[model samples]
Target chain A: MTRMNERLKKIIIIVVGLLMILLMAISFGGRERITAVESQLGSFIAPVQRFFSQIGNFMDEKTEPIINVLNYKSLNESLAKENEMLKAQVVSLTMAQKDFEELNDLKQSLHYVERSDQDNYISCSVIAKDIGNWFNMFTIDAGTEQGVTKNSTVINGNGLVGLVYEVGSNWSKVISIIDHKSSVGFEMLRVTDDYDGILSGTTNYELVGELYDTQANVHVNDYIVTSGLGMYPKGILIGQIYELVDDRDLFLKQIKVKPAVDFKKLNKVMVIPYDEYEEEITTYLP
Target chain B: MNKIFVFLMAIANFILMSTLFQQFRVYGVLANLCIVFSIIFAILFSEQHGYIFAIVSGLLQDTFLGKVLFVNTIIYIILIYVTVRIEKIMFKGNDLTPIFLISMATIAYHLIFFVFMFLLQSTIPIHQLLMHVIIEVILNSVIGLFIYRVVFKNVFGYKLGDYNA
Candidate 1:
């Protein structure tokens, strides 16, 4: 009799659990309804995650020799050699960039400069990461207290990072550009024939852009930047066109762009506080 | 008291895994400590406690990430109790049962999650995630083996939940 009762209880649990799963699955396509609950919980959990991050970082530094020697000895040597090569390349690139700026100044009046002043950005540190590598969403230490709000543009030193998705009192969730849902308007710097496209992220960790016309003359290594007409500030570097797929026959032709920001190594970001420009741009976004 | 301890431990594990252990990622996969704890909890206590904690931990994860809501909870449903049920039938009372179940549970839970999320129109690189899942399985297996001896069997032990070790 007791065995039968236990079995019945198990069956009841399985059935109820299935019903709950079905309800959640049906609502999967909609906006997550746990935003408020998450914000409250994030306020509680973020500091805990931050504390553990510090400890983990400490352990990583102290035991680096043991782990590195055991596993990354050869990997370290290769990385060192690669670092030297990259440093030299950077030096050469810097000189070339200086010359390019001069040429651009002479050729066109579109002198682009980054608005990275202390007043323009509220600097924040990453406190917690998403559960897995499936998506690049993360939580930052800044929140509504620091003037961060939902949909604010986030950028690191390199270039475009992501945008604020959710915000609490002391923390905010950032969704990186590599997410399939993210879309940013972009314009080609070299090909200034009014040839602009919207850059969107894909599942394969690639940023892709589709031009309005199928036969637009675009080439590999062409520079792309955020169009002044959208959420992101104008003239910020997006990436170089990596490849132009053979989608000429398709109605919406697409081109592959490598993102300027290295999503893998992102640690710190600066959130542009919501201002008149972003407020206006959000209205134009579909 | 024991239940509260388990709950606190589960929360702590979730916090640490998503934050601190992110640095220890290999192939961009962090070791899921909550899944490990849920497996241990289910085995030591009952299938009910295991799945219950699984859902709780999964909900906690949902708070951080914007994905299919309760997908983690739903995925975890099959993890704890089912693994425990399998252990009861196939390898009951074996000392290595926890280790095997933890590893299998972690891998299965993630694989099932990715598939379920994919079916929901979320695009995932199955090939790339598969590699990380394998790496995570091996990584969590080693971690489970270590914790089984040094932590689970001694520190918390089965006795806390009134189960014989």
Candidate 2:
């Protein structure tokens, strides 16, 4: 009987080992298939994701009042400072508006002039950021129900934040330009010449744009703007050149650009609707 | 009563670790409180109960965040088994052994996770990877020590003589 029990144990061990090996092999072979299934499953569970996100946001909102009560003095000081900044900005904008009217006459002589019609912007508020070693994403409160769609451009008052990757009923995920997979056609604002580069995120919360080719003539502090590609509108600010490299041994001259939008301070955003810009660009392109 | 308490604690710890404590990432690593809970549950409960709790916790984790199904459950079962085996030899309830055991268990958990990700062709940098493991282990150990005191002294009312039986 003892020998029979030992044989049973051996058989069990061998079976388990074989099963483990088979499982590992299947996992290796079907990774893409598994990921596709998972993503599709995620889409199906978008309502649950939205529910959890809403709960988290509600918790944060409830705590905010308590935090405000505890830090009332500091909050007041911050509000005062913000009010002063807004007043100064209002004065400056008034002056700029006058200057823009004067320059409207000179704009006729320019070769490629594009005017911004601001009627198509849908406002949104950022709810949460998915920042970890594995994933870098941000969630905004607007989604397909609110006229947001995949590939829609998200911008703040400063500049481009990211593009909408996934849209649920009431929430959307923005794949920030800082992510490794993000690429954009950018050009120097001073020259209006086109250059292509990829935007990548560093360990630190910084977006670095690496421009390819040595003859791009990009210098430190040069304003980087989008290339007016059919996707992104022209003249939207990308970032400012942070680092410039010019070594003979290197294959491409690279420049690190610091994004204009402060993601940490992100609270509100504007989503550029498809119809208005798409109509304008399609007329211009083909 | 004990089974219910363990199950509740496991779920609570999982939720807090994934949602609340996730915001406190130190050098891109957050403490794995689930590891601490698994170790404590293994030490406090029967071996069969410990294994059951590990599977439950792992399944919950898998449902929420796991990319590879069953991997976390298998690792957690191994962890419970190892901890239970060690408890048999050095079963002192009051010494620093529990802290040391939890620290080692967490480290092993992280190492296994790293190897799994590496096998899956993840591009995590070596420095960041090492930092993640060390930070999580240290944080879990510190938190586990305080938690151990509370669970044994207050929650279970476990005495020194309880282990001998």
Candidate 3:
């Protein structure tokens, strides 16, 4: 009787293992919306994560002062130099703003329709990050309760952070742009709109891209922004190009990008809810 | 009573890994506390207890991450089973036993995870994946040894040389 039970237990384990593998296959392929069970689980854990995250913040706050004290001299030197440069830029920007306002008034008088970009955003703080080192996903405090939805654009002061991949009642999971699974459509800032490419994240948490046309006038240090395609909206800064890999064999212009957002220190983010009706589909150039 | 306490510890470790331990990342790799705890449980207790702890920890991690359920759970269950089998063959009452077991478990965990991810069409390069695995192994070994000693002395109420088998 004991031998029979042992055999039965082994069979059950194998059967269950196969079923889990099958479920994982479906979940990965379907990439379906979050299920009710997952949503409930997320809601339950969100507050606990928030509490722990607060404790972490407190610890960092306490330790930061000591670390800053050690490097205060060098920090002060750099800040003074940067402050002077920023003061000069502010003066030039003020003059440019006056000219831009004058041109805007003239355009309005000519009966040009005013274009408004994104205006709705829900702010949230990062509560937890993925336990695995493989993916660059994190949990935030806001969720569908706060108008956050799946595929919503998440950004911070620096630049584009990522998109909300899963949403719960009181929390949401965001997949950052540095995740290997992320891909964004981008165009060079201030360059021809026709010159666009797809930037993707690698396992090393770095961004790499390939332009659609090899002949496109692209170079290092050129800024890249969302082309208003796919999940991300237009004009959100993605990153700047740092390296342009020349591949004559495949006739592809591969390039490397440095993302603007410092993902390691992500604290707060703004979520622009995904809306199909409000999406403005217009040609960016010509 | 011990089972319940172990289950709660699993939850605590999972929560801490996702929140507090993230701040302690070295070389862009965070030590997976869940894996470390799972291995420790398997080494210190019976195989059956290890299996139960694995399921709880793995489920908590998978649910919190909001990914496909049971992926981590399955990997962890297999890990527990392997650890138990290896324990029977090797001398486990040594100081370096936990570190050795943890290094092996971390490698296996990543290998299985990478295979599943590759099947899902992930685009991680081979060289980068190997580098990540190497760093994680080292990190897990160091962190795992620290945790194992604490669990040994506090939870099990065992002295340094009191461990048998």
lDDT of 2 by residue, A10-73 (tens): 5764575456546754654123223444344334544444445456556756766875797888
TM of chain B, each? 0.81, 0.83, 0.86
lDDT of 1 by residue, B1-165 (tens): 266676777687778777677777775677777677677667666676676678778887765665556777767777765777686765434446766787788778777876676667676667756776777777777776666555444545553234554
Candidate order, lDDT descending: 3, 1, 2
Model 3 alpha-carbon miss at residue B155, Å: 7.5
lDDT of each: 0.72, 0.64, 0.81
Candidates sorted by TM-score, descending order? 3, 1, 2
DockQ for all models:
0.50, 0.22, 0.64
What value does the interface RMSD of model 2 take? 5.6
lDDT of 3 by residue, A96-160 (tens): 89999999899989999877656677988999988887888888989778998778889998789
DockQ leaderboard ranking:
3, 1, 2
Model 1 residue runs over 4 Å out of place are A1-37, A55-120, A202-205, A228-233, A248-254, A273-286, B92-100, B151-165
State what share of the real interface contacts each candidate retains. Answer: 0.67, 0.04, 0.66
By TM-score, how accurate is candidate 1?
A: 0.74
TM-score, candidate 2, is 0.61
Residue range with the least summed lDDT across 10 consecutive positions in model 2 chain B: B60-69
Off by over 4 Å in 2: A1-132, A138-191, A223-238, A245-249, A261-286, B1-29, B46-98, B105-121, B155-165
Best by lDDT: 3
Better of 2 and 3 by TM-score: 3
Candidate 1 local lDDT, A133-232, one digit each (tens): 5677888888888888767788887777877776777887788888876788887875237677898887455798999767778889877777756557
